[model samples]
Target: MPEGASHQSDSHTQREAEEEILAGLAASLGVVLAKPERVALSGGVFVEVDAATSDMGVVVEAYARQGRLKGAQPKKIAQDVLKLALLKREPGWERTRTIIAFASHEARNSISGWLARAAAEFGVELFVVEVSEELRARILDAQRRQVMANADLLADDLVVQTDSGR
Candidate 1:
């Protein structure tokens, strides 16, 4: 390939990688939001679903910041999304009955501790998922499957199941 072509290919590859990373992040968030479980992470954050009547459930949200970043911190993002989800009440969604997963990897211990206390005050359970190489690969694979399934559905109106039920 020519030098220009090679450069173009590299740029394309980098863009694709970034897209994939963002997609994986979104997918991880989606899975956590969908599950109904009491979970909390080191950072001040929590997720909980109503237990008594199963009709009214709310996910309390909180987060801590360590360094400079943009937009909502991890915990704040999770909380905001959960609140939106609760308000929207998307199809097949029950009452807000899950602790939103908080992103605390970037926050300092002190801030995290404060956030944790705040989450506790609100009776929210915080959840944090450690990201390792293997975990990342798994998340990517799941995202790919979802994309493929969506594509197939759009093309042929068929539901594709990637899992073997294992």
Candidate 2:
């Protein structure tokens, strides 16, 4: 591949990985994954969310990077900022919770402090997989909740089945 093509390929691969991770995280949190999903606002207009959960009113923009934080911080911040800006312009979308999920917090540790501050100021959440303590905790909790919910559903179905059989 040419030098430019190689770079483009890498970026595309990184984005795919990031999108997958974000989708899984969103699923764990009971959110449906739909990229560029169109949602009808209070008005007759509709808006596109990068990934949104209809039930929870949450949207996420994910970023994946393989380098040290110093080289990527500004760009990542800019991307998050832009996403936030677009979401906020939609009438009711501003009320929707926004998140910027990174692939790994440690990968961005060099600018972790700055990211936290910027995310907060921008009214968007910042989370990472396999790195941030908070992200792990949230994932674990969501998993537990999902399992318990499934158990309940299964039990209820079993009871209904037995009663009908009798």
Candidate 3:
């Protein structure tokens, strides 16, 4: 398969997993949650959260990776934290419950150390929603495929260069 197609497939898998996690959370919380329309912030800026209750009382950003963070994954999670924190600063969102939901404990640990403390201090709650065994297997399988793909690229003398110059 082509490299671009492979990456797109991986991304699609991750997105589906995340959507599943959000659905599980909605069931656990007994509330219907959907992505709200872009929320207005100051200066005509707007941001969107992954899911929110109809009343906007609860907002969530979910991470569905089953393993530890890799590459820019940590930064991605931090960005979610930042989004939720900024949203909370909005006038009517001050009381909104901001949560960062995780599909696995390992993914949750990506925020360990000072970042974790900072998220808590910002009133960002961390929660883990259990995914089914089959979903868990699928996530693990995708992760393994991703790792192998990276290895294969490196072995093919592709001279992979990251933007960070790593």
Candidate 4:
């Protein structure tokens, strides 16, 4: 009820709202980003997506860091995705498809060079989307639903824990 406490709560809410927007952008792009049907593990933390049914196998892998929407290694991840795509004999993907999307304008600009390098290396495509105000709101709503669902699951867990403790 204190003024200071309310202000802090508001700040926290705003931060959460921002995070939800970024997550939504990522999720939306993820839906559009094509993936190979059979995701297989190759040695050295590599994954292969088999697109044998299509013209070429479009392999994709994501390297994520905690609290980082996209890491400094977009070029590397792009290269790996392209390599897998090529290994699957999906050259058409290189011409028709792109990999990588960032939630922020700054992040997108910072990684543009890396993205270009990777694209050139493998002859693949690249695209980036900045989080818009409307998209952010939609993402926040979806995130709120997810958070509520999670809270419900957590409440169930707490009940089980309490019963077990007794």
Cα RMSD, each candidate: 16.8, 19.3, 4.1, 11.5
Segments in model 1 whose C-alpha atoms lie over 4 Å from true places: 1-71, 74-97, 102-114, 131-166
lDDT, candidate 1, 1-166, per-residue tens: 7655432113343233333433344365553222236544334554453221123343333222222324444455445444534433444434444343322344323234555565454444454434445444544454455456656666663323333333
lDDT, ranked from best to worst: 3, 2, 4, 1
Looking at model 1, residue 30 earns an lDDT score of 53
Each model's total of backbone clashes: 18, 0, 0, 2
Model 1 per-residue lDDT at 81 = 47
Off by more than 4 A, model 2: 1-9, 37-49, 54-56, 108-115, 131-166
lDDT of each structure? 0.40, 0.61, 0.85, 0.45
lDDT of 2 by residue, 63-87 (tens): 5543345544667666765566566
> What order do candidates take by TM-score, descending?
3, 2, 4, 1
TM-score of each prediction: 0.28, 0.55, 0.84, 0.36
**1-166 in candidate 3: lDDT tens per residue?**
7655556136666777789889998998898999888777898998888889989899999888897888998888888888899989888889999999999988887778877987998899988988888888888888888888778878665554553366
6 Cα displacement, candidate 1 (Å): 18
Model 3: lDDT to the true structure: 0.85
What lDDT does candidate 2 reach at residue 139? Answer: 42
Better of 2 and 4 by TM-score: 2
Global CA lDDT computed for model 4: 0.45
